[model samples]
Target: MRNQGSLRSTLHQRGMRMTPQRQLVLDAVRELGHATPEQVCKRVQGTAATVNITTVYRSLDLLEQLGLVRHTHLGHGAPTYSADEHEHVHLVCHHCGAIDEVPCELLDGLADLLAEQRGFALDASHLGLSGTCRNCRENPTAV
Candidate 1:
């Protein structure tokens, strides 16, 4: 999370005003770590009942544009938003829908391979790898 003063300056630099709703939305995103817009809206509304889902979506877009946050597609559902500084690769369990984060360095070798062979620079943090989790694999009936 960034300092409130810096957030205000960033908005001002873009000719935007810093509203309480925006601040709440940002606070929610920071506090929640990784959340969908709906989750953000719910968190914001916990403090400011007037803050709606539309505002959350708009704030998320602006925050992303300002490089304060980033979004990753963890599954087929809505993309999850996290602070831009939260750099990691998400390991998603296909069977139980569990999500785990690993250091971005874990993808360094694959990133280099793809860059050399396919000219693709992989943004490991922007997506998740889906696989059956240990629990699901070890105890098929548990899931």
Candidate 2:
């Protein structure tokens, strides 16, 4: 979860008008943790009861552009969003379609190696490593 107080100040510093709709959308995203725009819309409507899907999408786009939100394509579905705090990557389960966070530092050596050898500075933060989770590995047919 994000610090609401700091988020508000960040929005103000970014010159964004802190409207009730935007606030509601931000609250929904924060509360939902990793949520899609549709999920955010549903959450916002739970309280505001008047916000539309378009408003949620616009809010998400603006928030992402302002570096307040980060969206990741976990698997084959819509991208999931979370508060943008630091560099991180997603560990996606291929069988069960689960997503987990892995610190970007874990791949720092690989990033450096790629840069040195292939001249590619990999952006691990925006990448998802797909593999089988422990549970899925143990029960291969469960999926």
lDDT of 1 by residue, 7-118 (tens): 9999999899999988898888889999999999999999999888888999999999998889999899989999888989998999999998999899899999999999
Model 1 TM-score? Answer: 0.96
Q: What lDDT does the true structure give each of the candidates?
A: 0.91, 0.82
lDDT of 2 by residue, 1-143 (tens): 45667667878897866778877877777777788889999999988888999999898988888777878887778787877764588898888888788898899999999999999989787788999899999988888
Measured on C-alpha atoms, candidate 1 has an lDDT of 0.91
lDDT of 2 at 88: 83
Cα deviation in Å at residue 46, candidate 1? 0.7
- RMSD, every candidate, angstroms: 1.0, 2.2
Clashes of each: 0, 0
Q: How high is the lDDT of residue 24 in model 1?
A: 90
TM-scores for every predicted model: 0.96, 0.84
**In terms of lDDT, which candidate is strongest?**
1
User: Which pairs of residues have clashing backbones in candidate 2?
Assistant: none
